[model samples]
Target: MPVNRTVNVSVVFNCVQNGANDFGGSATYTQSSSTPSDLGNVVDSNGNIDLRQASAYDPSQYNDSVDFVFTLAPQSTGYVTPVVWASRNGAGATIVVPQGGNAQEFQVEQSSATPQLLTIVDNDDDSNTYNYKPAVELPNFDHYYISLDPRIVNKPSSTNK
Candidate 1:
């Protein structure tokens, strides 16, 4: 039996199917390191590939690229699986910090945007702790960039919420 080589892959955001959709009003992409990075919150974690700044630059609007990395464990499994998914952060309103910014005010107009880049949380052990354990795949050294759907950049007022 061939053992899958354990390696780290970079998680990037580009564009995907849909091409059109918005979660609330802000679009989010979670890093492979298991962090929900907002549009402007660019960051990296232990298991991340350090692709680009969350709000680094612009690539069209609705259409964007994103992906999760897979790390193989020496001889644990011959192959690993990795898949991505999209979801609505909130209703019509973009994702809000719930409690932030002045007392009663709104934050950035880019939280609950659609085509959110959600993380593949491993809920195996029954514990709700978000572990950066994503489905790993056979290491090939090859890489690709996937995009996320785009929507409107809701720039509402602080009191809009």
Candidate 2:
């Protein structure tokens, strides 16, 4: 049997020049009592989070979910709004905005083994121009990107009772 894993990620954005140039952002996995071991080791040295079950298991049997919490520096708390861009292989993943929290909180559910890219862009002036936009509109700075690559371990046998 496969298992469902949950990973919590904390995103911090430092908006400089009102998110114009030289803006910086980072994301790190947050540990909690309910965090799964597989997802716990998700973060790599390069800061890329890959959703893969280390144990030998079939990918089809498991689903990985991520909870993202976004926070901006005090200077840009009300000035900049971060946007999430899930463009590469994004169709295989599902994004949900949780209620009760500010606009920065959201969840991502991924069931496919295909790799996907989620980019967080700092939206200054609180404009909607960057919302749900394509990758081509992504700015060069003041943003962070996370790579999701789910790996399949064992293949399920075709013949079954």
Candidate 3:
């Protein structure tokens, strides 16, 4: 039997005062188990977590989960709490964290093999309103793309006398 696996991702936000007042963010991932690794570091050369690589999994083999933890760096000025959303293939997005919510961490259960995309935005404007639409291009928001390739492994059947 395969054991369950968990992936931990750390998120950091930075506010840049580039005349236009821009925000920058980054994410990195680490797996819990190394014996049967199902995922790589997931961080691209640009120091961003891009899971669209070879993140393959087999539901029948093991259950996989991912946790995204957010952190506001000291340099992230004029920024309030963080809110998150998830969507697939340019469809409508679902709120993972509501505005002004006290939760700083969100959990994602990997049940489907299809690809997914998550967006994390800071409430820099301190507004209580939000639009849960995919690819809306909100300021101070970062995208974490996930692509899970399903792998089916066949097991040998047992023969009884």
Q: Each prediction's Cα lDDT score?
A: 0.25, 0.30, 0.31
Give the Cα-based TM-score of candidate 1 against the true structure. Answer: 0.19
Quote the positional error of residue 144 for candidate 2 in Å.
15
lDDT: which is higher, 1 or 2?
2
Q: Compared with the true structure, what per-residue lDDT tens digits does model 3 show for residues 1-161?
A: 75443333332323233344454333222222332365555433223333333255564664443332222123234434342322433322233334446422322232233223232322211212322222212224443332222111111121110
Residues 58-147, candidate 2: write the lDDT tens digits: 446543323322221122333254434434333323322222223342233332242233323221112111111122112333333333
Evaluated against the true structure, the overall lDDT of model 3 is 0.31
Tell me how far the alpha carbon of residue 78 in candidate 3 is from the true structure, in angstroms, after superposition. 11
Question: Considering only N, C-alpha and C atoms within 3 Å, which residue pairs clash in candidate 3?
Answer: none
**Alpha-carbon error at 83 in model 1, in Å?**
19
lDDT of 1 by residue, 1-161 (tens): 22111112233322222322311111222333422233342233333222232333222322232323222222322122222222122221222222343212212121223222222211111111121212211112122222232221222112111
Full-model lDDT, candidate 1: 0.25
Candidate 2 vs candidate 3: the lDDT winner is 3
* TM-scores for every predicted model: 0.19, 0.30, 0.28
